[model samples]
Target: MEKADPVLERLEGQIAWYDRRSQYSQRWFKWLKGAVLVAAAAIPFLAGIEAPRLLIGGLGALIVVLEGLQQLNQYQHNWITYRSTCEALKHEKYLYLANAGPYASAQDPRALLAERVESLVSQEHARWVSAREEAKKTLEKLGP
Candidate 1:
């Protein structure tokens, strides 16, 4: 496939980076919560007392709070990605319309416009695929 336009490539890179970072943060939080829960559950066995119950309860509460915060952060990140993607698409459409005649054929204006629109649509689709692949890789790196 042809290389993506530089501007689009940069935007995609930024979005991918942000997504990877968010996923990493989420994974870390999950691991931390799991570790805490495991430790809490083991406390009574290790201490030979009823401390496990208290520890587990406390850790559960902490996990709840952490989950809430993580959810909020994910929400905010999603908003940012949504806005950025929309803005980028809008700009692509505008550029397509502006250069329609030049990029394709001026002899048949409607045909040229259609061709430009198709090209932009294809580019957008490819970008989406690339972004998704990047996200999948990042998620994989974070573990299952």
Candidate 2:
């Protein structure tokens, strides 16, 4: 059996972390989309007024459509990223497990593996935090 390359193993770990993160991000997008749809549906009733009522309703509807489209685009992008990452990780994991029989266990190797995993986890956390911040900024741009 072929031995797993450490470089490939590390890449796989990173990819796996990203795939999970993408799944979570997609869920958030879905929720946002739903809220947009509900707001869009209520625009007419919510805008009940004589002056600028129709204008307000139209603007609300427009905003909802735009937000929904943006969320959908983000969702699609995340899915594509997630799929590619998952495939890479699976390939790397397969190779790593297959090659484990040959390599003699060493303290240094174990430490390296632990560090790699930790780094991947940290990177994923940072990505999620960045995403949240972006979402907050977007919301702020939309309004108070």
Candidate 3:
């Protein structure tokens, strides 16, 4: 028996999406870095024990591959970016809900909320696109 608010719905949905992505990226970044550290730390120990050259070489390659994946996918960047967006969105939501900040002076607070929410989401999308393009350019610069 309650009417749903589209603006609030959008705000909440975006918050959840960004938060989820931030957590996911953070987890992946940390996991990949951890793997690289472990592999690297093991290399010296293995070498000291006179392990096969192939094994040591493989560990070095593993470190490269893991670090490359982290750079290419930009998990750390995404984690920070998404987390910032999520926090900004939450700040807007709280302000709108409390009729504080810019919402306080708006005649149509819902419309203002919608506009602000869309703007935040749009800015984030633009940043995401830029990040992809930057990654592409970096790859190109690296060449074959």
TM per model?
Answer: 0.36, 0.44, 0.95
Q: Tell how far residue 97 is off in model 3, in angstroms.
A: 0.8
- lDDT of each residue in 25-48, candidate 3, tens digit only: 999999999999999999999999
lDDT of 2 at 78: 62
Point out where model 1 deviates above 4 Å: 1-105
Could you give candidate 2's per-residue lDDT for residues 115-138 as a string of tens digits? Answer: 545554565456546665777677
lDDT of 1: 0.54
Error of 2 at 135 (Å): 16
Candidate 2: count of backbone clashes, pairs at least 3 residues apart or interchain: 0
Q: Can you list the residue pairs that collide in candidate 3? A: none
C-alpha lDDT score of every prediction, in listed order: 0.54, 0.61, 0.94
Question: Residue 57 of candidate 3: its Cα lDDT?
Answer: 99
lDDT of 1 by residue, 15-128 (tens): 465456546655656665576577556655646764566665666677666555544344334444444544554554465457642544467544544554445446655665
Against the true structure, candidate 2 has what lDDT? 0.61
